[model samples]
Target: MNDLSRGLAYTFATGLLWGGVGVFYSKGTEKKESFYGFMFLSALLFFLLTWIFAFPQGAPVREVLLVAALMFPAGLSGQLGFWTMKKALEHGPHGIGWCIVQSSMICPFLAGVLFFGDSPSAGRIAGMSLIAASLLPLSAQGVPAVREDSCSGRFLLLIFAAFLLVGLQQTLSLVPSQCPTLSAAALSWRVPLVSLVGLGWLGPVLFRKTGVRCGEIGWISLLYALLVFLGQLGIYRAIDFLGKARSSGTAYPAACGMSILFFFVYCFFKRRERLSRRALAGIGLSMAGMFLLAIS
Candidate 1:
C-alpha cells in the first residue's frame, strides 16, 4: 500500500484500540479500582516495554535530548488530559469522554499553519469549522452521564478540559515533528519519562487503595499499556509515513471519529448505557465533521 493508505489504516486501527480502552479501563475503574494505581501500573509496564524494545541508542545526543526536554511538557499535558478523561468517563458515558478527548484535532492544525507555514485549504477550514460547531451539541446534552441529580456543567467542564489538555499535548508533538532528528525518538523517551512522572503522583494511590493486589490487576493494566502503546505507535508511524499535514489534520481527527463510531456501537449493542437522542445526534454531527476533514 501507499503511504497515505498505510497511514489511514494505521490511524484507524489506533482508533479501534483507543475505543476499546474505554471498555477495559472503565470496567477496571468500575470495579472500584484505583484510577491512579491502575494508571501507574500501566505506565510502569509501558515504560519497561519501551526501554527494552526502544531504548535510546545514540551517544552524546545533545540535540535530540534537548528536543526530548521540550517534549517533556507534552508528556505532562498528556497526563493531565488522561486524568480529566478518566474523571469524565466517571461522569459520562465512554463515547462522551472519547468525543471530548478526540476533539483535540484543532490545536495541531493551528500549529501547522501558524508555526510551520503550512497552507490551509478551504476544505480543512470547513472541516475545522464543523468540528467546532459539533462541540455545542455535546455541551447541550440534557442528562448528565453519571448522575441523575448532578449538574451537567461538571461533565461539560470535564469535556472542555479533556479537549484543551490533549490538544496541547498533540500540538507539542509538532515541535518534534519539525525536527527530523527528534521526531523519531521523541515519544520513545518521552513516554517512559511520562510514565515515571505518573508514578510520582499515582504511586501512593496504588499503595493505599483497598484490596488492590498488584497480581490481580497486573493483566488489566498490562492490557491498558499495550493498547496505549499500540495507539501511540500507530499515530507516530502514520505521521512518519504520511507527513504531519495529513496525519494530524486528517488522519488524527478522523481516527478519533472512528473511535466514537465503535464506542457508540458498543454502547448500543451491549446496552451498557442509556444514550439520549441528543447525544446520538451530537455523535453524528461529529462524524460528519470528521468525514469532511478526511476527504479534504
Candidate 2:
C-alpha cells in the first residue's frame, strides 16, 4: 500500500483503539473505579509493555532519565485533561460535555497551520469543517443534561482547558520525531517518561491502600492501555506519512469520526442508547466528512 493508504489504515485503527479506551473507561465507571488510580495503573501498563525490552540490555541510565523527564510534563497535562473531561461528563450536560473533549482537536490542526508550515487544500478544509460541525447537535443540547438553562461557565471552562491541554499533548508528542536520536526510540523514550509520572502519581494510592480495587476492570484497563499505546504509534506513523497538518486535518478527525460511528451502532442499535435523530444526523455527517478526508 501507498503512504496515504497506510496512513489511513493506521489512522482508522487509531480511532478504534481510542474508542476502546472509552469502552473500558465506561466499564470502570460502572465498577465505581477511582479515576486517578485507574489512569495511573493503565499508564504503568503502557510503560511496562513498551519499555521492558529496552531495559534488559541496560542502556545508559542518565540519557534514559533525561528522556523520561522531558515527556513527563506533557503527559501530565494530558492526564489532567482526561480526568477533567470525566468530571465534565459527570457534572455537565451530555452532548456539549463530551463534545468539548473531541472538539479540542482543533488546537493541533490550528497549530499545524500556524507553526508547522502546513498548507490546507479545499477538500482538507471542507472535510475538517464537516467533522467539527458534526458535533454541533450535541454542543447545542441545552435542557436535559445542562443546568442554568444554558451551557454553564464551569463546563465551558473545563472544555477550553481540555482543548488547550490535549492540543499541547499532541504537539509535544511530535517532539521525539523531530530529533533523530529520539525518533528511532520514540515509544521507548516517550512511553517510559509518561509512565514514570503516572507511577509516581499512583504510588500513594497503591501504597496507602486507597480502597480502589482493580480486580474487575483490571483486564479492561490493560486493554485500554494497550489500545492507547497502539493509537499513539498510529498517530506518529500518520504524522510521518502526512505531516502534522494533514495528520491532524485528516487522520485524527477521521478516527474520531469513525469511533463515533462505532458507538452509534453499538449504543443506538444494540444497547438502546438514548440517541436522538439529530445526533444520528450529526454522526452521518461525521462519517461523510471522514470519506472526504481520506480521498482529499
Candidate 3:
C-alpha cells in the first residue's frame, strides 16, 4: 500500500481498537467490576508484551533518560485520567462521557500551537469554539431531573477532571515524538516504560490481599491490553508513514472521530442510550469541530 493508504489503515485500526477499549470499560463499570484491578493486570500484561517485542537496543543514556522522564508523568496522568473517566462513566451517560474523552484531541492541538510553534488557522479556531460550545449541551445531558443534585455535581466534576487529565496525558505523549534527537529505536522503548510506570501507580491496589484476582477478569484484561498495545502500535506506524505534522493533523482526528461514532453506535444498540435533541445537536457540533480540526 501507499504511504497515505497505510497511514489511513493504521488510523482506522487505532480508532476501532480504542472504541473497543471504551466499550469494555463501560461494560466493566456496568457490572460493578474492579476496574482498577483490571487496569493493573492490563498494565502488567502490556508491559510484558512491549518489553519482549518493542524494547530498544543500545540507545544513548541521555535519550533513554529523556523517555523515562516524559513517560513517567504521561503514565501517571493516564492512570489518573482513567480513574476519573471510570467515575464519570459510572455516573453519567455513556455517550457523553466517551465523547468528552475522545474530544481531548483539542488539548494536544492547542499545545502544539502554543508551545511547539504550530501555526493556528481560522478553521482550527472555529473548530475549538464549536467543541467548547458542544460541552454545554453535553453537560446538561448528564444532569437529568431524576438524579440528585449531589450526584449531578459529582458527575460533572468527574467528567471535567477526566477531560483535563486525559488531555494532559495526550499532550505529554506527543512530546517524545516531537523531540528531534530521539530515534525510532529510542522511542520504541517508551511504550514499555510507560506501562511500567503505570504499574507502579497501581501497585498498592494490585498487591492488596483483597484485590480482585486476575482470573476473575483474565480474558477481558488480556483483550484490553492487546487492544491498547495494538492501538499504540497503529498510532506510531501512522505517524511514521504520514510524518509527525501530517499525522498530528489527520490521524488523531480520524481515530477520535471514528471512536466517537463507534461508541455512539454501541451505546445506542447495546445500552439503549437514546440521545436528547440537545444531545444530538451537541454531537453534530462536536463532529463538525473534529472535521475542521482534521483539515486545519
Ranking by TM-score: 3, 1, 2
Q: Residues 192-230, candidate 3, lDDT per residue (tens digit)?
A: 777787676376564653475677777887888888888
Q: How many clashes show up per model? A: 0, 1, 0
For model 2, the stretches where C-alpha displacement exceeds 4 angstroms are 53-70, 93-96, 142-152, 178-183, 186-188, 203-209, 244-249, 269-271
Question: Could you tell which candidate, 1 or 2, scores higher by TM-score?
Answer: 1
- Lowest lDDT sum, 10 consecutive residues, model 3, at 142-151
Q: Quick one: RMSD of model 3? A: 2.9
lDDT of 1 by residue, 1-296 (tens): 87767777787787788877766666566545565667777877777776676575453467557656766787888888877877766766665566667778778777866776555778777777776666666545422455552336677788789789889888776565566565354435554454455555465564675534577677888898888777766766665555654444455666666776676677667745556777677777777776776666
lDDT to native, each model: 0.67, 0.65, 0.73
Model 1: per-residue Cα lDDT at residue 268: 67
Q: For model 2, what is the C-alpha lDDT against the true structure? A: 0.65
Error of 1 at 268 (Å): 2.4
Off by over 4 Å in 1: 142-146, 149-151, 180-195, 206-212, 244-247
Sort the candidates on lDDT, descending order. Answer: 3, 1, 2
